[model samples]
Target: MSTQPAPASRPFSIMPPPPPPVPLPVRARSFALVGTFTASVFLSAFLLFLVQPMFGKMVLPLLGGSPAVWNTCMLFFQAALLGGYLYAHLSTQKLGVRAQVGLHVGLLAVTALLLPISVAGRSPEGSDAPIPWLLGTMLLTVGPPFFVLAGTGPLLQRWFAHSGHRNAADPYPLYAASNLGSMLSLFAYPALMEPRMRLAGQSAAWAMGFGALALLIAGAAAWVWRPVPPSAERADAVPADAPALSHSRTSVPWRERGIWTFLAFVPSAMLLALTTYITTDLSPVPLLWVLPLALYLLTFTLAFARRPPLPHEHMLWLQPPVLMVVVLLLLSGFVEEAVAAIPVHLAGLFVTGMVCHGELARRRPAVRHLTEFYLWISVGGVLGGIFNVLVAPVVFNNVYEYALSIGLACLARPWPQERRGWRGQAMMAVRTVAVTAALLYIGANSKDMNPGLLMASAAALMLLLTLALARTPLWLALCLGTVMMYSTVKAIREPGVLLAERSFYGRFKVVEFGIIERFHVLRHGSTLHGAQSLRNPRDPITYYLPHGPVGQIFAATAPRAGRRKVAVVGLGTGTTAAYARAGEEWTFYEIDPHVVRMATDRRYFTYLPDSPAKTRIELGDARLSLARASEPKYDMIVLDAFSSDAIPVHLLTREAMGTYLDRLAPGGVIAIHISNRYLDLEPVVAALVRERGLAARVSSGPDGKRKRYESIATWITVARTEEDLVIVAADRRWKPLTDRRVPPWTDDYSSLLSVFEW
Candidate 1:
């Protein structure tokens, strides 16, 4: 009994001993391999997205700050991405693993030579085809580097799959990692990088990152390379759940590839269409461009995640309701304020993108066809960019492409797997027509009915129709299409619009308003650019009304010497020309040709023709046009470009201030119209002025209660010294800016967040 008790002695610890440590060599090798590939991919994507906004910012000064500039940049990026995907597909298909590694490593080294990207050439002067010019310039600037980086995602994942690792069977999670990098870069640019760093600093840092990425890529290549036969490697890499066909030998069906492309197209198009719609229809909030693109990249991360938190089925079920709410908001015109409209539209875009991209993840082909799958997806993205950038502007007068894309996204939603009988189809058709007809009735009688009641009725009908046709994608698409058509048509054909034109710059309309006074207004989006009295065309109205801040600026700066010369950066209806006096010379720099045409048409505006000064119009971006000017100096420079609310950031940087100072005559003043609904630009201008050791005075006009045509305005006048601004500084309404410091914006860096009103 004593011996038995001795045998039952307890162990020293409760826990079992740890298994033998992974062999140090094996552990280090594995860690190095996995870490190298992941870091390389992450760095590549980070560099890829960072270059977009960086290069876009550089290009904006050449082109005016039209939202189209971003859209055009997106087109170029997509096209380059497509080319990269094609290269990846072909190279992987034709070459062995070792050969692929050598080829890719060489590519990274070559692309490194083009590091620290910058715009290559000046925009052609007076070129009507800015799109081509922009695309060509970008091609020379960032194309090779972007193309190589774009291929890193698929290429690295393919390499990892053949590495003979335990987790090689399923390599899709790396795609989520890739997109994660992209999303972070987008957020970082606006939040951290732009606010803290200069453009030159950012570029240098990006170049350093590229160098590190090349080294990482070389490590990944060395880890994956093998002397074994290609067939043996492919056989070893085949996943247990994958089909028997070797990825190397198998050919994906064209129909499947097409399905992949169609799934990808809707979301890609929606990304741009929604961005344009938001910036065009709502407030052009600073850095708002990133929100849509960030959401766009986020969908890819979620869709390809190892375990998606929100399942594809959930997005499918959730999209219709969100889409219906967006339709209601658009139709009712209730959510006009940027605070409300922005979140609503952004949510809609996120949900819609999730559905499309989720479907893409679900349908992704075997590892063997990975590059091909990405190639088709890239094709879809390029097509989307082309549609929105090139085709939509010519085909539709308004932002009709945005609505069209929404309808198309509805069609892209998963249809019922079970075929519908004729009775089911007939029922769907009946419900669609009923909802569409009700919408039409509401639109037709909108003026006669109380807006709230009409909106309520339309919302109820749309909700009912959405639920009724939830299982039928085609009918749901048709109903939404009808709603969009009617709503947009009504908005476009408002009673007062005499002329409506669309260009890459923006939508422009000459709207007749004020029955008693009879005025024609030049409107861009929701902001009034300039307006003229039909009875007295030479009288400035709206933001430039006599007695307003701008009027005060002109009065204060009126020439006391012989033949003063004036330069106007933006020529909205040429309203500032009304301030010109006899023997004075005026030059107007206008970016949009359409605006120039309307301003000079005498029928719509006579401010320039009626002015007594020797006035001339120059068509181009203001900064570039001004740089090319032969004039030695300008007595007064007026900045009137901010009224449309898309503040051309390039025009407000410290370098821009230097340009203005260079062109300014001794004792000359610079007048900037800073009246804005969303941005407190006086602070920005003040910061710039103080940075240059200049004096500035700000005029905040009264509420214009005395005249219907006059509008409340704000203008800031800057000069080399306080004495130069004495004329405005003496007025009670014009306050001298304090020397309090805020971060000054330079050519390398600017943050809309710094000056955002809210």
Candidate 2:
């Protein structure tokens, strides 16, 4: 009631009720812009990722379980991705927003006709190369669909930029979300889809998801029909490198494009190299493949964020040290130990990938140049894949590509370009010479020194070198020389070594190691293929020892009445041939011809030459060779083919088993060498046995038993009838294989994920 109270009421509100809660139509448009585009990208990425592992599993049996199969698959995928990015770039530039929408939608509709993917054939017929055949098969089955899916990421990101949203200044964050979808699909495949469904069912589900993606894409296209305001279009026209908008209309510099290509190439090549190292040298389980790839994708997700959680400069600093650790691991011989090797490899992949991808994100062009950026990155990816898959195998005898890639990654660092003063130059020279001297000293004294001590010293020396030369361009050349010198010293020569051969299949070393009595050990990577006693040339000393299941197999079958025919799938040191008797017909089917030469050589193995039976060697992939060969019912067929520690998955499929059954004489038994440090192969054999109505028994070596030049062996014997299995099954050492319910491996589907030990 007082005048003072009236004066207090005058200062009511300068805020004006918070601007009317944003007009409904405006709010609706913004929501639609983000929601529709993000959904489209996420679903498209999921489908893309889901199909990779699914189709990889589908084709794995066709080519056997070589890690190279994944490499080839990656090559195809990268090519497809490049094609997609190219299409996106051209289409976006040539077409208006609505026309772009119409074109892609029409293409998607057309591609939908090829949905519900299925493998075309089991494998190529006679005279066909497996890698090319596999590539052709992939192209026929999933190529068009994958290409279409891959294009959606950049295309939809471009669409969102023109949708009149306030956050239109940036579209790269959507890329992070896209990668999240990719990462999720990778996790979902092994964790849910693989374990629960067969390949056919998974394909069906993927097709359904594709259809949903099509609908979401259609919804996103609706935004193109609406009018975008001038201000919003201007938002997307902002320069990628701010404070420098003068060249907005000009083409990006060639140097910047080259930087993008280089940044992308390092990570892409590193991914495949690390995957191969883990699968071929560590463990060939498909899950091991998932880890490196998942980390690789996750780096993209972390890097391209609007505000990256981890800084690019930090990765730049962290990468060199981690790279040094990786190089040291490669040289230390711990690569043979899975427990020690796997973590180091995966960690190196993640850090180096972070550095490369982080640089990519930092230098990303404007929204106006989004497709151009993506196109260059994809080209880099395809080139990297080609180098690893095609070029490296032909150029290098060993897996030198992995080491070479590590050095290239070091070169990718943003080294200081300014001229250093004399003091700084002198310091750099000193550091480089010191590193070179230390590595050369280690290499020279590697044989005489304690390997552990030398390895530790090398690691310490590398750490110091990394710290000193981190900002210098000379790190690349120095690191490469260190690797080459170290590898040459350690791997090329050994005391009492007979010979070493490296093929695309793997490295094979025939070394003589024994204190009192010399034994010739045939080693593939770290696993013993066979060992022959020089004291008794005919004596099979390793897994094929006289008391092992291989000896039992020949004891029962080699003595069969008539002209006995025996088939061995893997010709490891030809040790199984030692069990042969006079007039026995023995044929070894070996995937690696080098293995055949080495095993047949009287100087190295002599198991084949020393055997009393007549032996013939068939050189080619075991399954393909067997499939093409004339029908000859054998008394006993042995499945013992292995690459590194991994059994070729194709050799264990029902189709492969059928091939074996077709080749076997009535009542003949199949002896499978299932001994592995990482896989429970008995279960695989048991599942196949149960599904085929066959009887099987497992012979396991004594727990914790160690013998001279010998290893613990586990053999699974399978036959059409229980009586046929009697010879090995009746022995107390051999017991009935576990009959646990597990899926039978097929050409269409299999999951070693379930059977992996760790």
Candidate 3:
């Protein structure tokens, strides 16, 4: 061999030197790949959330700013998100990776074409189908864009799994990042976007951001497409007999999918129901809306995090007691206290969401099945949303969805899946039947019993159930049912349903009760809007009492020349119509068609029918309808447009005041009902009138023991000058409102936080 090599005497090596060790091609740095996918997920989330509130605000004027408008919007978003997740799941599983990338990129590009979102087709004008119209309008406006946006997180994560990044094995942490983006965007909408920019400006800026997200997503896809070494590719292939990494390749059991869906459903439904509860019972201020949603997103952020600070077991254990308190508060009317109730409801929502979302995170499958997991979650969200916004309203009379959601949340606990022995199972069945019978009995007999005693008894039973039957799924379900029965029992026990109506506005329960059961009351949420003593239908009761500010306003304007034209904003039982004299022109501007119907129905409320004045009801937002009314000016304009306990924020803004003034005749007085359990609206009205260079007086209704129909009312009376409100000005009982430290609310801005009464 040596001689041969010598003979050859060629080049450098004796014996064939090892072929030049093939230099391995350097891999593109993985840091950029991971960051690119995360950033893409974040941006997509931000744009999606920013567009939600932006578009919701843009359409608010058309829908009269009802909380129901937000509810309907949430439903549409959930449905769209479900579609997006489904698309992601299908594309990832059914299509090749390259096709998935191409399809998603194409979708994003097409969605961009519909950017700078605006409502298409005029808002439903004079149509009774506001919900249908809302759904249709939202479907046309942001539907495609949102669907595309919704797919971004799951789709990008799926791509990241195959991108060969160091952390590609688990993509769950990326979900936390996505929710963080959503939380930031949600916070920014009210604080940064809405306050500083108009809808058009917000939309344009959002479109620009969306375009940026598209580029990041494309970058992520490119990273996924980068070529890999043959060894790495071979290593990635699992042997046919190799065990899956935590069940990565195994088909997700139907039961596991069901658990994911049920867990996801609880949180989504609770989010909507809690929003409605807070906004409806406290104030439908943007602050209230943002708070609940912020908390909701926070749960997702925490649950899907890389290292969850709170364990799923901890959340599961913490939820039941909090949930019990929540159901009790809801049933016992403890939520009437906004200060106490708001926090209680929020706490309940947080704990419940944490348990549900945390379990979802715990049970999350490997990156291989990431898209499917997300798809099931989205499905659950959509179903929950539909139940709240559609099914509940259609099937039940009250906001029973809220109570039902609590029950569902309790059942969502991750308990033992395997059944106990027949004896144990049989015992659980017997307990379940016993609990059911008890619930039915409670539902039937809770009426006429002491609330304190009933609540005590229910609490005791819940404790017993949790102790004896907590380990069994059937028993857990029974416990949930028992809680629901407790809530429903209270509603059913309440006397007299003149009209149990649901509308885009909210639930209206026209209940009857009092000495000899002579009074018919209009209640929305837990607040009483009006009450009419069947014996005294014409005598204004509650806030409309003869000696109250509302009464004084009407009495002062009673002697006006020509027809005493009176325009009232909120129709709440049409009690203001009772102030109308014979032959006077009375027009009611009502946003809720149900309220109009309730007020006009002689059997329900006779204030509209018993009015001495000729009455005409205009159906639409009061502000919009007032703008369109080119009528003879009214001597007295009553802005009693509060819904239950919520202020129609749109109606109280400075622009809204100007509208009222424009419709007012010379020397006409504008009376605003400012009485609220949770807000000191006197300052708001004071600041507004002061800005307008008008004289304002606030009358605080009697503070002594309230009569059966009488409540403590606060009214702000603003007039062109002191001369117009001579009677109110002269009366010492009506104090002058001099506090103008707070800024007046405008169409662009209002701070419920600033004026929030503790």
List RMSD in Å for every model shown: 9.3, 8.6, 10.6
Global lDDT of each model?
0.77, 0.76, 0.75
Q: How close is candidate 2 to the true structure, as a TM-score?
A: 0.89
Query: Which run of 10 residues does model 2 get worst, by summed lDDT?
Result: 1-10
510 Cα displacement, candidate 1 (Å): 1.5
Q: What TM-score, over all chains together, does every model reach?
A: 0.88, 0.89, 0.82
Best by TM-score: 2
RMSD (Cα, Å) of model 1: 9.3
> What ordering of candidates by TM-score runs from best to worst?
2, 1, 3
For every model in order, what is the number of clashing pairs? Answer: 1, 0, 0
How close to the true structure is residue 8 of candidate 1, measured as C-alpha lDDT? 14
Q: Residue 565 deviation, candidate 2, in Å?
A: 0.9
TM value for model 1? 0.88
Please give the distance, in angstroms, between residue 226's alpha carbon in candidate 3 and its true position after superposition: 3.0
Q: Per-residue alpha-carbon lDDT of model 2 for 462-569, expressed as tens digits?
A: 678667777775654575557656775666665877887677777667888888888888777666788888888888767887777777766766448347888998
Which pairs of residues collide in model 1? 199-748
Ranking 1 against 2 by lDDT, winner? 1
